[model samples]
Target: MLSLPATLTQDHARECLEQLTDGLQAEAAQVVVDAAELRQFDSSALAVLLALRRECARAGKHFAVQGLPQRLRDLATLYGIEGLLPAA
Candidate 1:
């Protein structure tokens, strides 16, 4: 399981993505991201997740997220991309 940072904004998007991507390489067929610690964040957080989801797909792995905050879920719904981030 991979964990998200407490704060994930546009400023940290790139670095966070790199770190998560590296972590993904060591995961099994199922990739579960724990987002409960995420507090301060922006849409970039979703961007990172989406990128990670794509990366998982490319690697033929299953992807899911856990502990997604309601606000973030709302954001994803508003963007009409909630389906991309499956819950664990």
Candidate 2:
């Protein structure tokens, strides 16, 4: 599983995405991203999640998010992309 940082703002989004990009290459048939550690973040968090979701889909791997904070869920909902990050 890939863990998100406490702060996932524009300043860290790129690096976060890069890290997740590496995680996606794992040989597992599915990827579970644990988001409980994420406390401080911005819309860029959703961008990172979306990118991971897209990458997983392209690789034919199931993607799920675990321990998503309510605030981040709200952000995903606001962006109308919550469906893509199904709760694990």
Candidate 3:
């Protein structure tokens, strides 16, 4: 499982995405990202999630996000990318 940090903003987006990408090599059909810890974040968090999902798809793995914060959900919805981040 890949866990999102509490504060995911532009400051940490690149590093966070890199960290999550490291887990994509796991030998599984589905990749699960836990987002319950996410609290202080911005739209950059959504971008990180989407990037992870894309990487998973390219690896022929299913991507799922767990415990996504409501704010992030609203952000996704606002950006019209909610469908891209499947709930786990």
Worst 10 residues of 1 by lDDT: 50-59
Residue range 3-75, candidate 1, lDDT tens digits:
9999999999999999999999999999999999999999999999999999999999999999999999999
The model with the greater TM-score, 1 or 2, is: 1
lDDT of each: 0.99, 0.89, 0.91
Q: What is the lDDT of residue 9 in candidate 2?
A: 97
Task: Flag regions of model 2 displaced more than 4 Å.
Answer: none
Candidate 3 accuracy as lDDT: 0.91
**Candidate 3 clashing pairs, residues 3+ apart or interchain:** none
Alpha carbon deviation, residue 15, candidate 1 (Å): 0.3
Q: Report the lDDT tens digits of candidate 3 across residue range 1-88.
A: 8899989999999999998899788649989999999989988999899888889989999999999999889989998999999899
In model 3, how many backbone clashes occur? 0
lDDT of 2 by residue, 1-88 (tens): 8889888999999999999989789748888999999999998999999998889989999999999999989888888888988987
Residue 51 Cα positional deviation in candidate 2, in Å, after optimal superposition: 0.4
